[model samples]
Target chain A: MLERALSGSQRYWSWLIFLLVLMAIGFACYLYQFKVGLKVTGMSRDVSWGFYIAQFTYLVGVAASGVMVVLPYYFHNYKAFGRIAVLGEFLAIAAVTMCLLFIFVDLGYPKRIMNVVMHPTPNSILFWDMIVLNGYLILNILVGWNVLAAERKGVPYSKWVKTLAYISIPWAFSIHTVTAFLYAGLPGRHFWLTAIMAARFLASAFCSGPALLVLICLIVRKVSRFDPGKEQLRTLGVIITYAMIMNVFFFLLEVFTAFYSGIPGHKHSFIYLFSGLDGYGKLVPWMWTSVGFGILALILLIVPATRKKEDTLAVACAAVIISTWIDKGMGLVVGGFIPNPFEKVFEYWPTTPEILITIGVWATGFFILTILFKIAVSVKEEVAS
Target chain B: MGVSRRKFLKISGLSVLLGLGGKAAFELLAPGSIDAAMEPAPIGEGKRWAMVIDAKKCLEKQEKDGCKECIDICHRIHNVPNFGNPKEEIKWIWKETYEHTFPSRHNDYVSEDVHGKPFILLCNHCTNPPCVRVCPTKATWKRPDGVVMMDQHRCIGCRFCMAGCPYGSRSFNWGDSREAPKELNPDFPTNMEYPTRSKGVVEKCTFCAERLAKGQIPACVEACAKIKVNALHFGDLADEESEVRELLRHHYAIRRKPELGTEPNVFYLI
Candidate 1:
């Protein structure tokens, strides 16, 4: 099945080549960071986690989105989702791959990553995160490939593969929850200290992950012989709509708790992010833009007419992805660090080299995604023919 | 009868667990035997190490010409290099304004002088240190006696401790720790006795763990006292007869962000 990926058209090959070039540049910068240490990045004692960890956090959610398709197909036995279950599983593989690369790049000593394995501290949420993420990745790969193989041969997927599919449903939820715990459990980081952190994380992840998947499905419809089906796309839009609403609602709860409590500790971080505190307004515009996009996503998605229209649905999906990306990828991590424990704002923005390395990781994820999707679509096309 | 190897292994594991359980039960029942666990380790004991910074004396020194003498001595001893960029600079003991150091406590009506001047700052070595609790590798841990100690060699440089710390005290070695010596102070031996850290490891005050092992005080405390101002006082907070306790008894000392309940060992007397 994977061999089918090697036989793509000229446009596909060129896209792969372009992504490979970006990866080369990113890999080169990572080497420089490896030699020079993390100094090449725009991180500081104040802002210890800048771009890399945030990307890791967001991708964990993206990896978990595969569950949305898996649940409906396996549990509810929805036929439409069954057609696209392989697509969701493949997306999980690519996202988890990138999630891993982001974490590797963020480590001050990438070589010592195995130390976590050697000295397994169960007290550290990061340890559990590593376990769940690896487990999720392996589960998806096995289930997605075996199921596709079974489909190609015109037979039922084996019992073991079905077992894995069920395990992956819950495992997907665990990965993002553990990632949320990584920040939520930290003391004195008031912004991340909310009880709703895990809930917020899951909600955003569900919406953003499926939104990105829908965008890809639209593209696949144009480029390949197989269509994921209109019903599948429409169902995904509904999932994204409800999830985005919950995500926004959860964010508002955070806002209410901070402001109503009037505890300067809790309120100051919100102030620092939305407005600026003590004259640091760097994240203000970005945060507002995220809010605006979130509102737009809700408007375009909630209205049945706009959502039913294919073009409008794509636009809404794009809005959801962009909005959630900025909120989770930029606002959440940086906002947590702002007004440092001392309640002073030390701003952080990714340096060019940092951004390039980030691009490299994203390209690497997409390159993997492109190949995996190509294989899945090719398999589907073969089955239909 | 000969037992199977698997059963034997299970029995052995259960024996170990029971042994630990017995010790815990005994500690709960008796006071004398529990005393052994409280003994100071060579690195430093947890509550055994603390610093009391006299803000008045520090302010006077700052008024004179900026007392970076303690900073220089500590950084030089620890081989902490100056990377020039704030984003990458490393510090062990340094000066920060009272307002910045105690922002939670800072208020608008407070005397301009109190929050205006630079105050001595370093790791609090909290009784329940968050950094120690958060390290994925146990690279940092709270000593039984009370000091928060770090094993730089074991640090995987994930910066989890940095995010966990409320004080912003930990510093990451973003570049070679020995660069300053190689570039500017070629004659200096890069503090050969103290192991200089490699890039990508998080390093901090360690409450001068190396000096404590040798029965000496922190470098900044010694340097401040040598100048005869007595601004920095390092002593055991666990001992009732200790000078730090006496200082606490006599002065209205405050710990940074006391509301966070970290129970910081470092106290400041205004």
Candidate 2:
């Protein structure tokens, strides 16, 4: 099935080559970072985590979003999703791959990463995160491959594959929940200490993840013979709408709590992100941009006529993706570190090399995604014929 | 002719689980073996190390001549790099103003003497250390003596411990310490006996565990005492008659962020 990816149109080959070039550039920057240490990045003793961890956080949501389709198809018996369910699983594979890569690039000692498993501390959330993420990645690969393989042969997937798909539903929730615990469980980071963090993570993930899948499905329609189906795409758009509403509602709940309580610790990060805390608001513009996109996405997704139109739906999904990406990937992580432990503001911005390395990792993920999608689409085309 | 792919995957997965289970069983049966491998010889048995900083005395000395003997000596002995940029600077012990050191306690109407006064700051070596709790590798842990210790060799430099520390006590080696410019750190590793850390590791004050092992007090305490300020005191908190305990008994003292429930071992006499 993978060999189907080997033969593609000139456009497909060109896209892969383009991604490879970006990956090479990113790898070169990474090598430079590895040599000079994390100082080459925009992190400091104050903001120890920067872009890498932020991307890791965002990608975790994307990875978990695959359950949206998987659960509907397998448990709810939604027939429309059957054609694109494998696409969701494949997207998860790519997203999880990116998540792992982001974590690796962020490590101060990438070589000693195995130490997490070597001297595992059950007390640490990071240990559980490592277990859940790797487990989720494996589960998706197994289920995705087997299901697609069975489909190519025009047979029902085996019982084990069905069981794995069922298990993956809850496992998807676990990956994001554990990632939230990585932040929420830490003391003194008031920004992340909220009880609603896991809920917020799930809400945002459902919206952003499906929104991304919608865009990809549209792209797949253009570039491949597999029609992903209008009903399937419409169902996903509805999922994205409800999830984005929940995501916004959850954020407003946080705002109400922080302002109503009038606690400086609770309010400081939000103030810094939105209105500049004590004259340091590096993320202010980016945060507002996210807010703008969120409102636009809501407007586009809520109207039935616009939602039915493919062009409008694509615009809405793009807005949701950008909004969620900025909110989680840029604002959420960096905001927690501001007004540092001593109530001082030390800003963080990614350096050139850091940005390049990040781009490289994204390219790598897309490189894998292109091949996987190619194979899945080819199989679908074969089955249809 | 060969094992099927599914069967091979099952066999490998089961073996990995078995290997982990076997290790767990070994540790459960003889926990001392793993403990002995991880911990060095205890500096003192059944002891809880604590420090008392006489903030009033320290402030008086600072006003008199800007005394920074404690900071200088601790950094030198610990081989903390001087990057000259606050963003990348490393310090095991340093100073912060009263407001900055205790942000929760800062107020607009505080007395001139207490307000804006510099306070010596270092790791609190919390009884319930968040850093130790969040370390994925147990690279940082609370010793039996109540000192939070960091094993740089074991640290993966994920900086989770940095995020976990509420007081910003932990510092990561973003750049190689040895490569620090001569003007900034003229005598890098001023004490050759102490090992300077490599790039990409979290480090913090160890409560001078090495000095305590040699039957000497922390360098900061020694430096302060030598200067006749006698502002820094270190002793066993478990010992009722110890100087630290005696100071706490006589003087009103406060630990930073006591409400957070970290129960920091370091206390300041105002």
For every candidate, what is the interface RMSD in angstroms?
A: 1.1, 0.6
**Which whole-number lDDT from 0 to 100 does residue B250 have in model 1?**
98
Best-performing candidate as measured by TM-score: 2
- The DockQ-derived docking category for candidate 1 is medium
lDDT of 2 by residue, A298-358 (tens): 9999999998899999999999999999999879999999989999999999999999999
Model 1, which residues run further than 4 Å from truth?
B1-47, B180-189
Docking quality band of candidate 2, CAPRI definitions: medium
Native contacts present in candidate 1, fraction: 0.78
Instruction: Name the runs in model 2 displaced over 4 angstroms.
Output: B1-42
Q: How big is the positional error of residue A289 in model 1, measured in Å on the Cα after superposition?
A: 1.9
Q: Per-residue error at A79 for model 2, in Å?
A: 1.3
Which candidate has the highest DockQ of all? 2
**Whole-model lDDT values for every prediction:** 0.89, 0.94
Q: Candidate 1: lDDT over CA atoms?
A: 0.89
Q: What TM-score would chain B receive for each of the candidates shown?
A: 0.81, 0.85
